[model samples]
Target: MVGYFGANLDGAKPLNYDDYLKVPQLINLQECKSTPAHHDEMLFIIIHQTYELWFRLILHECDSAVEAMAKDNVVLAEKQLGRVVEIKRILVQQIHILETMLPSDFLAFRDHLKPASGFQSAQFREVEIVCGLKDERILTAFDDQPEALARLKKRLSSTTLADSFYNLLSRNNFNVSPPPERSQTELWQSWQEKTAKELVRLYLAPSEYYEFYRLAERLIEIDEYTNLWRYHHVRMVERMIGSKIGTGGSDGVAYLQRTLGYKFFPELWLIRSYLT
Candidate 1:
């Protein structure tokens, strides 16, 4: 065990494990709202708290990856994005632990959680925004919480992972900008054609653009794992409550299911279909 203080004579405060981790405060945070607290409520609270902590870390990694990519540091960006992919896998697996609690057991304390829902997790929202999923409606959703709303507003206005990735490509001499004055569909088609051609070139000549090719793969992996996490989360919600409404008045499983179709990097995925 690491000692709190070394034997040196200089007067210094000692730190124990609890002090280092603030374990006392951490353990005390699980306050059960249900009167005659249900046994499963503590488990529910702890699992969700753990998710929020992990979200904080995920956001950190994503922001680092964006900054690295902005500086044309493909290797560092890939490293940070790889960390996010692994963290997403853990997020997918962690939801299963809740399945161990029977639906009836969950209901025993679910009602105690009124109007408060996981839908309002500010950190999770931040992760989505950083990863390139920006929706102004999300800003409206948090209108009641000033701090959370402000953080989300800032993220909404900032450059995202997609912007950084495309910027890196531009720096590498790729013409990623869309043609001017075209209809929305025509612009999309033109952009996709250009991106697909470049991606195919990179795929066929990986040695010529090894760093960029690797960065593209890392980005695709992040998109893949994010969708996987959403898929598993939907199943977990379905298992927990069937079609029942969520604690925050949202369509619980249905809402999660819809999110499964969202992709952070559409051009990356489109390139695969266009590839021979």
Candidate 2:
């Protein structure tokens, strides 16, 4: 009964482990859509479900990191980003777990997932937006889902990790501004160049900005692990489906390959080129 998960139990009844953790509800969430339920269908569903959970935690840590940067608490911000970097490592490793499924086994239940794709993962989009990958094209995919659209709109309007990092640097007397009257692309290029120069200074004299240097390193690690996840995911898909169209109407491996270039902290990585 739903009452089993209720928290109103007083002295008359002690809280049990199952009730405390909602184990009953959690275990029942996986529902295979395959007729007669193909064995691998459960694996596919659980892998994706687990991915969403990781995305949720990534969003949570990113929010905290942004808040820490807002307060110019670089130590706290770096700590939060450290957790995100570790989570991304786990994500990259976790995608390979899908390789455990034989291609034939996945096909047995693949049809049941048509029109429902990981492309619709709003939380994943939220994570990208929060990390500075705000693409409005993703909004069109969620036009039919009111809650997802609303959440994404809020994320779009929110300050991103890149914004927080730049603001933190500006507060510390770094010149983070781009000159006015440039075209959009030029403006972004100028901004990256400015940030890259400042990052080079940090790299050259890390002891002077040690906290910030560590924070920048964590940002780079997060971006690296994100690309690693994308790479592994594309390889896994290709291994399973071999350039086939995605169930969610995407170009499958090709579409994922395009995402390999996404960078949440471009300036952090660009600094490497100027390190010498």
Candidate 3:
């Protein structure tokens, strides 16, 4: 028997904040590979661990948004997506915290991270997959880890946030369906154009289609913040390592630069050009 806050609960253990959040175990997880543990290594580990937590939450919210949209609940879907947008803002800011570390400080422990890099974050990849960036090449990186590969495969085959939003538009009588039997990039561009044509109407008369319009705008914000995060991350990496190859053997800054233009909701962005 123990007291929880004030009331007594018989035959039950009281829950403390530390116990509930597993603070002890969580704090212990930042094991630095550097012998003697470089002073900046703790900062490096904690920042990335925090990112994984945020990525998990982002996935949770995105999945909820998808479910909400599937049921034609645009308001709830938008609400969930709004959380993702704000979290992405935090993600952009969070990466900059690494910038405070001197290049010399990071180099003290850099070599210890060979073959392991942010590029290998499976949860982040799942976030990309859930948000509609399905590239099979990413899967090859996880061949040695079956659990992550399985999750990525599930996310790849599942309905993405973009798929849900476009389906919602279709239910509202928009022409989002693809031209039959088209293949490859041509088919992809055609689908984007067709969806963009209808999406433009939402922008033209936002108040008339408030639900769809609001949700679409939220998706755009999410996409925008996603790009912003990528841009900032690239800048941070460039600052920390210059032209050096990544610990994960990636091209580092150059590879990150290539990811800048990715959009989770391309049609929503395409509508902007057609606005006038």
Candidate 4:
């Protein structure tokens, strides 16, 4: 039966849609853990599953963009970053679909999800790390999950998108040296000032540095859409369960609200104020 479903047994068959994408396996993964299997539970599972899949694709595009930038291929990096921006738009829109589920409908299955909160989403954290939002503290939560812990550790130790961008600028002869790491907040603020000054120069002579100017704008779009996604997410969560604690032991809406203030590329945003 497994062979009939296009398993690699005998290895003699052409690939079909199910073989290529494993549609059969993918469709079967929505097994509801709720007692009696609440109808809304399926929607909840599929929505979050789709989110993780999109998050995976976003991470792929981000890595590609960073690689392209490292190679001084601004065009390729811009193209890949454009793809990430579009995917984030889709992410923002997807929240509304979950909001369509009435609060009572979610409550029916929410209890079954205790300790399985979206806070534990390893892929989402990977996306954050790849996009330059590394926080070592978050890794402590996944200590029991060795596979995830390993991946997060690798991300923590690696050069992030922000690092690669500055390196790209340095290759182009911009002064991208960051201040000493006395404190993360201080380092970020110092870097922000330095980067904004450089970006302001680029903005003034955009035709001369057309590619870098465009890259900076694309980075700003990424920052903008990320904040939009967070804002929409917080609104959706509040609508679903006002002030309630999250399934993963978080403060739920409050925690998400706090995250809205985080900017992956603050210099990209701050440059606007310095622009003529």
Better of 2 and 4 by TM-score: 2
At residue 117, what lDDT does model 1 achieve? 88
In candidate 2, how many Å is residue 113 off?
A: 0.2
TM-score of each: 0.91, 0.93, 0.95, 0.92
Tens-digit lDDT string for candidate 4 (150-198): 9999987776777878888888889885322324777768878887887
Clashing pairs in model 2?
none
Superposition TM-score, candidate 3 onto the true structure: 0.95
Candidate no. 1 TM-score: 0.91
- Which portions of model 3 show Cα errors greater than 4 Å? 1-11, 178-183
On residues 156-180, what C-alpha lDDT tens digit does candidate 1 reach at each position?
A: 8887887888788888788775222
> Where is model 2 poorest over a 10-residue stretch in terms of lDDT?
177-186
- lDDT digits (tens) for residues 1-276 of candidate 3: 456564447756567689999999998999999999899999999999999999999999999999999999999999999999999999999987899999989988999988888888999999998888888889988988999999998998898888888788888988785222223678788778887887788889999999998898888898899899998989988988999998888888998999998877777778888889
Candidate 4 matches the true fold with a TM-score of: 0.92
Query: Per-residue lDDT tens digits of candidate 2, residues 184-230?
Result: 67877777877798779999999999999899899889889988988
Q: lDDT winner between 3 and 4, please give it.
A: 3
Clashes of each: 0, 0, 0, 0
